[model samples]
Target: MSTHSYDAIVVGARCAGAPIAMLLARAGANVLLVDKATFPSDTMSTHLVHPPGVAALRRWGLLERLEQTGCPAVERYSFDFGPVTIAGTPRPIDGAARAYCPRRTVLDALLVAAAVEAGAELREGFTVEEVVADGGRVTGIRGHARHGSSVTEHAPLVVGADGRHSAVVKAVRPGQYDERPSRTAMYYAYWSELPVDGFETGIRGERHRGWAAARTHDGLTVMPFGWPIEEFHANRHDIEGHFLAMMDLAGDLGERVRAATRESRFVGTSELPGYFRTPYGPGWALAGDAGYHKNPITAMGINDAFRDAELVAGAVADALSGTRPLDDGLRDYQRIRDEEVRPIYELTDAFARLDPPPPEMQRLIGAMHGNQEAMDAFVSVQASTLPAPELFSPDNVARIMREAGADG
Candidate 1:
């Protein structure tokens, strides 16, 4: 087996891993980025990068490249709840007033290229068979490429940016908290000529059903519908029928979808386990879904991954460069990550249950109807650009109700 060494080894090369590698390499760290799959690959994703994520892309100087790919900017968000359809633009984040839904095939490849260009070593098709450890400290990784010899690489810091089922997490056995069982299952497919103005989410709270549609790359719209977890197995055999039936509940959106042509086979999962693991331990650290995962109901995964990549890269660079102790830097990464994401994590869990809103929430929804300012703020909360507590405060709710001529 061949051996190699680096300052940091980043496993998984998608949104989270690629950016961490890019940022770390730019910070002057020797970075080795490996992934089991090669570039320009598609994975199951909601694909919506909210405004905050778009700002991250801009900061990294990759936003223009994404725009060049012809993925349309989603400038508005609409939430349909049988009784009312609240449509508005979310408050901008860092001057990025628009969201995007680039196909993962395009987005992931772009990120990997940025990482390589920043001087990170790329090892595509590398399967990490083992996360080598010594004296309870992770020291390196052991893996091989397809049809290639096994090799081991050592690094003081090993980052698990591999999705939810991360191998490093398996090896490190990070303690988990706030864990929740899967509450919903979703299936989606691409459709050609499916015209949608922007991001649309429909919630049939009474029936515990929800669906979303967004225009993606190459004039295709990606539509996803979800059901309570209990219904996942019962509807699995006939996903197409159930998917259409659920969309039909969206009224006009359903009409348009039924008239369009599906361009891809259905893909989905019921394995979305929500949790937060101790993000750092000894020489091993976690980022992206490996450290924290929640329901995709809010489409926050990509945004959260981008934010955490920046956080983790900074922390890792500080530690590796001897500007701070490794434990201190890694701990700060966890602190900031949890602080920034906990609110959305809780909201995602609540939405994933697919339960009807309580009477108070229903009242609030009604009060915001026809009030563009209130509607924008509400959508901003869902977009995670605004804190839920701020929008849900009694004063704000009462003000909205007053403006709508409804009882507070």
Candidate 2:
């Protein structure tokens, strides 16, 4: 078998790994990246970049490249629940930046390119078999070293960015992470000329039907929401039928979404997480979906991946530069990932736990009565600015009550 060496070996060169490798290499580390798939491929993601995520891309100097690779800037997200249509201003970055929807098919390839340009050696189509470690500490990883090559390679640091079923994680911390299936799953696809109807505004998409749909610059419409996995499994034979039916149930906007398409296929995905940890050990750490799979509503998984890559890259740089203990650095990595992003996860989970409102919620909803600011608050809450519990907080209500009392 062939053999090679590097300072770090990163597996799953997609959302997480590619970025991490690039950042580490830019910091002047010798990096080797591995992925079991070809570039410009789709990952199991909704692919909607939030503003903060867009900011991270800018920080990475990959934003312009992303735009060149068919990224769609989304401006507004319209929520339609049957008869009520609530459209809110899309949150912008600084004054001009807006979130974009880029197909992973486009994004991943661009990322791999960036990593390569940043002086990283990327080997795609090389399946990672296991993590190679020394003394219960991460040291290297063993896998199909190159496409059509059974060779193996080792490095000082092994990074797992291979998404949910990370082989690196399975090998490094076997039997460590436990996951809970998401309450809802989705069947979505990309389109070339489709639109989300009235929300002609692009970027962070607006709805056409009751479904949450957005159009990418490449004209891809991503429709995702909560639906049972069992239902999805049962309808595999006619997924398109089920998808259309759900859109119909959603409303005419959904019907518009259904009719707006001429060429498209479905992508199936399930969201699950028991707050998976054990993300770091001796000579390695995990980044992106490999460590934590988020509830979909947050739309922050990819964003979190970028954020994690930055943190993990810094951890590695510090460890390699003799500035800190690797273990301590990784623990700090986990703390940041777990503690800092917990609110986003919790917020998304709250949306996942959505049930018909109680009478009290109905009364509050009645009070909103078609106010744009009310809807802005709603969107901001969903986007994880306002804490989940505080969305309907007593103090907020008290302030509103005082204002209404004075107005009356």
Candidate 3:
């Protein structure tokens, strides 16, 4: 039992949870943020922060700290589609012409530090044992500390910032929406001295296999990923071997990786289903992977997490300040999140299937060459700042063709 009452209790103190708690505390709400894992610890992540994600960090006042931590800036993008390569600079986000890939160890710790500075009480190494429910509405949580003490904390709202297998999401059992089946299994690791020339590269390999490589936190991260689901299950026992084999299939990235030092153990997942669960209920809400998750094929997880933190925080703040009903305010967060993410979710889901590109896609890829503006638009889809339709629309196609003189 606890006498302390917080306005919000956020579980899982990573990208999503920490920011939500930080914003709440900054709005003068008493917030408690807890995580099972300690800060400065590495978790499995693709780690690329795209331009939109960088903008979110800037808005949260953490981008300077991230830049200070020695994470390299990625200024360009290269997409190798076998017959064609589209190379261009990513569009700037609020004057930031580059993206970043900080190690999760560094990023998470920095976010937690910001939350603490904002007056959120962050409890690392604390595991939520159960969701304390009263009359069918979540009132608090019972959790145990790493060193073995049980404590209960109460709050008006309990947020599940936990990842895909979120305890808070499970306990609440909120209705699900936009659920899509798992498509691609992915494996990735860090390497040293794998040269990229400050460009992040995405290689579309033959037979539907693909790989992405980018500079991040003193090393190069290369991920080999693809589908058919069956292959993932068959290769479960020999993941490292399978991962290396997949990387070997990755055209130019394979050669560079072969020449570089393997600096870390390979990490990956066989299951990555995409979905959006209703983020809020009676007294509980979800954010990050718990509320909405898309396939990592687009490398949008961290960025989306950052974006949703601002959204959820705003909604919660509005409700707490008596500007709107809590449920209505939280629903606004869900609606906006859906509107912003659904397109990317569908695009990434399509990519994750490892299906053969349609003839139209092949033509579109060919069209991007020799046309820098079209190429930039294409890269924006990857950065997530531009919607998929923006590149594929008829008007854009007409302009691209005009620029290429193919329309004539």
Best by lDDT: 1
Residue-level lDDT of model 1, residues 1-408, one tens digit each, is 446669999999998999999999999999999999998898888699999999999999999999999999999999999989989999987998799999999999999999999999999999999999899999999999999888889998899999998999999999999899999998889999889978999998889999899999988999877999999889999999888778778899999998999999999999888999999998889999999998889998899899889988988888777888878888888898888888888888888988888898898899898899999998898777888889988999889888888863
Summing lDDT over every window of 10 consecutive residues in candidate 1, give the lowest-scoring window. 1-10
> Root-mean-square deviation of each candidate, in angstroms?
1.1, 4.1, 1.8
Tens-digit per-residue lDDT, 1-408, candidate 3: 778889999999999999999999999999999999998888877788889888888888888999998888888877777777888887776766678888888899999999999999988999998898999999999999898889999998999999999999889998887788887778787788888755545545346667777778765564545545767778778876766676666677778878888877767887788888989988899999998888888888888888789988988899888898888878788888898887888888888877666777777677779888889888888887778877888998887777767776
lDDT score of residue 258 within candidate 2 = 53
What are the lDDT scores of the predictions, listed in order?
Answer: 0.91, 0.69, 0.83
TM-score of each: 0.98, 0.86, 0.95
Give the TM-score ranking, best first: 1, 3, 2
Q: Best by TM-score, which number? A: 1
lDDT score for candidate 3 against the true structure: 0.83
RMSD (Cα, Å) of model 1: 1.1
Q: What's the number of clashes in each of the models?
A: 0, 9, 0
Off by over 4 Å in 1: 1-3
The residue-by-residue lDDT of candidate 2 on 1-408, one tens digit each, is 436668888898887899999998998998998888888787667777766677888888888888776666776656554435556654454343367778788888888988999999988888877676678877776677454645667787788888888888787764444355575565567654566642321111122111366777556577665455445466677876766666656655555665676465676665455466667776777898888876665577777888889989988889889999777888888887777676666555544544444455545544543666666665555444344455578776555444445223
Question: What's the ranking of the predictions by lDDT, best on top?
Answer: 1, 3, 2
**Residue 130 in model 3: shift from native, Å?**
1.2
